[model samples]
Target: DLTPRQVTLRDRTTIATIVPFSSRYGVPPTLLQYLSDTMNKEIEGGDTYPMMDTMTTDAFATYWFQNFGAIMLLGTYASASAVTEGNDWATQCLGSFYIKPNYTGRSSHISNAGFLVTDSARNRGVGRLMGEAYLAWAPLLGYTYSVFNLVYETNVASCRIWDALGFKKIGRVPGCGNLKSYPDRLVDAIIYGRELGGPLDEQAGEERFDKIRFYLKYGTYPHGADRAEKSRLRSAATHYRLREDDVLMLKGREVVAEVERQWGIAREVHERGHGGINRTTTTIAEKFHWVRIKETVSDVIRNCKECKDKEAAKTAVVVPAKRKLDGAAEEYLAGSEAAPSPALRGEQEQMVGAEQNDEQFHVPASPPQADKTLTPHQMDGEPYYTSLEYSGQTPNAFQTEPHGDLAPVHLHADAALSLDPQIMGPMRDDFTLGYPQLHDSTGQPQFAEEAFHIGGHEVGRGRKWEG
Candidate 1:
């Protein structure tokens, strides 16, 4: 009834768990199959790990298991209930890494680990979780230091994770990997190392590095009486770095933001869009090593006049007033949507026939229709609707109804539908009644529109047209 510690997975939502799965106890068949499969896949791709002579599952077991070390797994499940006695959840493994001795008994305190993430689990931030777990697990496993002997430079994701976790790129081996993907070129590999944040960091922060940087600078040991103390300081100095900027970095990563520089560094990070305490602290800790950084960030954020103002603004009530605009011409109401300028409007228009004299008559140049009109009875089985073509200036208004025998007729220009008396028969022609059998249907105009668009415009309200 042992329950592994659960973590909220990379998605920041679902639950993931980490557990120790030792080779001695034997791995679950499915989980071992997955681990071996993932390693072989990485080898075949010839980019992540070095290309090996034999990529068989047996080779993977020997390489990843016993002869090297034991594995720690980060895994998740479909549901909480799926976590059971048989370890079914391990099939959903996010990633697995082996922790083993980097050297024989004397230097075994320094451990090495190889990390592999499942293809299904790439880019889920679980790689970082695996890295973080390595730091924690390695130390508890009695290892004081950790190292990765050959991380390919092309493995940007792995480099980024270790960099953020404060692992230093201490050495490089140029053109070492004859990878399958790069048949003609040899890819360079880097050596990365870091203190597992173990007993070495147990000493007070300043008390630890101030003397180390001094020796790396001056080659003089601390003015101490005891041999053990001198030797310890020298050992610590090897991992601590002194930069050209005179900023002491441990293992090539973190620049310890000293007591004096702590505020400025924290403030500098806070000024990068000013995230709240946890965010600001996380950002600062990613690059700079400050003592009590979370507390330092909290103090900085508390004193941040900017954050306080923003907090107040979030809670502040908004007061609004009714808006009114005054003008005979177009005007905007205060804070309301302004009318679009003329350039922003789209003119809706189509081609029309050439113009002619108001008093003249002529034939239309195309789609020649007989220059004639039809009475209601004459259009019994014809294909004529209202005449579309017109001569001269278009009419002001179309009369829908007329007096006497001229009641309810169509009217138009002389070209398309001539107004000549012979053409404009004393009866309606251009239009015919749907129910021509009714005697009273003559009074009802076939169709009429009070508002019409002419020459790409509607007759204006007051005057948006020719006066």
Candidate 2:
């Protein structure tokens, strides 16, 4: 296929390619004979093309029509005069190639293409230029991918050009063929492929302009408008005829943010002054279609700490008033007193009460006893276990020990098991083991001595003498 546009290389050389038409170019038979002869010479060399053998002019033409539906004639011109002169026009005939769906039928997305540059055009960047043109045309022809099937490893120039053009080497078949230039030595064949998305790029550009087209037709922004206004906008859009000059192209949000950073924020700071909100607002309004341009500029400058610091530096420094600070501290204290902490009702009050009295105490006592000195025998019960019984019980309920000599069960007063002991002053209440039966059975109080002592004096004993 022939491209409608021409490509100019980095060296300022313009190149173009087309399929030879006898009626159009008026080329003499001699030029066609020379092009066919030069192509066969390159194929016979065997360093680049995989022809395996050379062909005569008629055989090559027949092979070209059978393999490729089209052929490309690449021409390089140094000046416009050479093109119009039509003699010694410096042209190359790219060989026919077969590229199609793979055998599996799943890789129909990619089209395989192969070609060799003419021997006269070798080392002149003609291959690279042709490859670039092929890639550009492949996408336009509805092909999403293209692959070079057999790039010999010995051909370093071709490989370098492909690599520079962003083609990835997807595969390598080691020692695939013998090269004539390398004296019967075999070289690996490399496969290079590239994804084509040129058409989709054009589609994306069209979609970007769609938003601007909508705004131009209706003369109103698309978003943040009410239903009544939208109805009126639809009527306006129906009658409106947009001119080319009315196309106000707006960018996406990300591009807008970048523009604000570079132009709006950075420029104002570099210009050595806070140019006021109105100036910044007008500067942005002239260029962009922000949803709320004034608010957006105000927010960007207001939140910028650097801008604030610069503005502050230009003004006089004022010392903080001592009385104001003192008044603020007093206000905070009064507010804290007004709403007491929840902890003051329960845990905090208990902690405060404990601190006020010198008497020793324990808190959150473990299960079975708040009284630390009480033993299992004194409670008249067996030891408590959280797990299953040794007799294979499921631990659903308590079971007494099957012993005949077990002591009678005793029920202690709830007050005796309280975790917190009441405290009044510098002394505690006389705490006693209130087991009357144990006292009567032993003929003496079991806890005759005090559990606590202070200042080397028995305090809060079975009987109390002082507070």
Against the true structure, whose TM-score is highest? 1
Candidate 2 regions with alpha-carbon error over 4 angstroms: 13-32, 65-109, 198-467
The CA-based lDDT of model 2 is what? 0.45
User: Please, what is the TM-score per model?
Assistant: 0.39, 0.35
The sequence of per-residue lDDT tens digits that candidate 2 reaches over residues 34-53 is: 55676687688877776777
Over all chains combined, what TM-score does candidate 2 have?
0.35
Which segments of model 1 are wrong by more than 4 Å? 1-3, 67-91, 198-467
**Residue pairs with backbone overlap in model 2:** none
Residues 1-467 of candidate 1: C-alpha lDDT, one tens digit per residue: 22244554433345566665445235555566667877777877878876665456666776777633333344544332343345533446677778899998799899998888776666556676667667777777788888789987656557656755777779989888877766766777889999886433324334345556666777776443158767877787777778887677865567563443676787789988989888888887777774467856765675566887898998774432233334211233333344443343211100011111211322222332343222222244442323333322222112122221212223343324333343324224333433232122332223223333345566321111111
Deviation from native of the Cα of residue 341 in model 1, angstroms: 67
Model 1 RMSD vs true structure: 24.0
